[model samples]
Target: MTEEKGSMLQSVIHPTAIIDPQAKIGPNVKIGPYAVIGPNVTIGEGTEIMSHVTIDGWTTIGEYCRFFPCASIGSEPQDLKFTGEKSFVIIGDRSIFREYVTVSRATGEGEETRIGNDCLFQASTHIAHNCIVGNNVIMSNCAGLAGHVIVEDRVVIGGIAGVHQFVKLGRNCMIGGLAKVVQDIPPFVIADGQPARCVGLNSVGLSRAGVSEEVRRELKKAFRLLYRSGLNLRQAIAEMEQELDSSEEVEHFLRFLRNADRGICRGTKE
Candidate 1:
């Protein structure tokens, strides 16, 4: 080992911690007892790994991230087709993983599971292989995301919710507790129940995100056209383009609706 690899700063790591010599640990990082850091792991400045946490594989963790006890990150994928191919898990800054949260690496070679900044994953949350999670997202306790899910910014996933693989959740959307999400959820919506049906707009979420009243009203109009007008997807898009005033928010909504590959979630009564 080179002198740099052999001379890791040991002040913050507990005596029982086992960090590979090749692991790159930045300044002010704190590692607690019995934590295992793999050779290919890179932890950024001010990150904290608590007791019994295991960070393995080719993982890159950003600055100020915190992992509570028993959290496991960058583990091999659980897919049956995994054949020991190299993959990665990349996380952004200031995220928190609560006790027993697990983030798995992607299945294909050179692929990665990526998470954005300022996300909070509560206890026992599971992010399966190849998921892409956006910034400021919140996953309540026991929420589980299947492989290949795409979660956009500022979304809230309630406790015990289970998202199906390949589903896309749009920005600022909210999913209620125990929801079983099987399809795409459009932007700024609220969905709940088994099989996850859309119920209403996420007014509170939009307000918290500093969306203006004018934009919110336009969004409401768009929502009515999409859900209550009894129009199909293409027809609703046409109506929105023709009737609703142009705004960045409304245009994003139309684009999301247009690109809903797995199909958008249906209305509650539909």
Candidate 2:
């Protein structure tokens, strides 16, 4: 391999660690004791793999990422339909995987389990097969996303929360601890309780994200129409179009609602 596309020998690889010669290791990377890196893996520059971490499969980790002890990445999907197909796990830059975190590769050939940049995955978090996790997301300890789940940017999933397969957690939303999310969570809202109902807008999260108060007020109107009003989804959307003002946030909120094939989480349980 040429200098631009070659493995640079680590300055600090523990003797107990076993990394394949064919594996592509970037410059300044550190491998701790007992870590196992497979040949198919490509770790980017300056990444750190702690003790006992196992990285395998067709995985591409981004630059400056850190994997804590016992973190297992790029294992094949747990799906019953996976048949040894060639799939991939692509993680973006600056992500941190805490202890015992497991991120599985996709199930189908040529598919991918993709994670975006700057994400924080806490201990014991499980990202199932074919999941698409967007940037700046945070998954608390023990939170698990089932196969094919799509977590949009800046979402916060609380500890022990379990998201059902194929459910989409919209951008900037927050799922409460111990919540069971079975439906789609709309953007910029807080969802909680069993089966997960929309409690309110994630006002604090939006504020921290630097959302303007004017835009937030528009979102509050959208929330009221969607959750507080006695209207069905169609009615709520129609009301939103007629009464509420337009902004990027409001448009995104409307677009998420329009794609609620799995159905959005309700404000209350029947």
Candidate 3:
């Protein structure tokens, strides 16, 4: 049940599958029984679409990805103001989506929902319209991200967490299970609770990501200055700039703090 085409093999599509004639399926892909691929969809090479999966709208999926059964991708956004304008969902390579995961396309015309490489989305996860997810991110079961949220690289969202709309989760951060994240989360921190306050630095995640020990110490100092010193936000930032050695990590941390519009999560008073 295989067909060779040029340097790559054509897909093995089940007889029960329904693929639109204009859909573009890449080499070595597999579409299982009862799967439906809509006209504007493009699936990349070696990707697998399992049974009952529905890939609709103007979606572009990257190579070697796996879509589990009952996953629905690139559907129209849930926004009530959406007027059926054309939009897209673009997913990167090697991403794995488990059963019943749903990803919505953008709401505005010509806008796109973007996901980066090597992400793992567990069962029942929902990524709302126009979300930007960076590489190596992991979303555990039932985690939901609202519209226009930004998730940076290597962020791990625990099961049953819900991130509010317009929130930005920075790189290497971890959100504990059942958290309700309403504000921006800066990089290298661990946040949890009903409103998801920062509890400590994400030492384990930073260590696994190979962040240098010197940088870690500097980050610790910066965190203490920002949270423990009782200084206001502006004062803490100014002090950090003046006191800390200018490393890449320090610069990035400061930059994130400066750019935060929803205000960064606060730490619990010890």
Model 2 misplaced stretches (Cα beyond 4 Å): 1-6
Candidate-wise lDDT, in order: 0.94, 0.93, 0.93
Residue pairs that clash (backbone atoms under 3 angstroms), model 2: none
Query: 38-117 in candidate 2: lDDT tens per residue?
Result: 99999898898999999999999999999999999999899999999999999999999999999999999899999999
On a 0 to 1 TM-score scale, where does candidate 2 land against the true structure?
A: 0.96
Error of 1 at 36 (Å): 0.3
Q: Which residue pairs overlap in candidate 1's backbone?
A: none
TM-score of 1: 0.96
After superposition, the stretches of candidate 3 with alpha carbons farther than 4 Å from their true spots are 1-9
Enumerate residue pairs that collide in model 3. none
Model 3: per-residue Cα lDDT over 27-110, one tens digit each: 999998899999999999999999999999999999999999999999999999789999999999999999999999999999
lDDT string, candidate 1, 138-213, tens digits: 9999999999999999999999999999999999999999999999999999999998999999999999999999
Query: After superposing candidate 1, which stretches have Cα over 4 Å from the reference?
Result: 1-7
lDDT of 1 at 171: 95
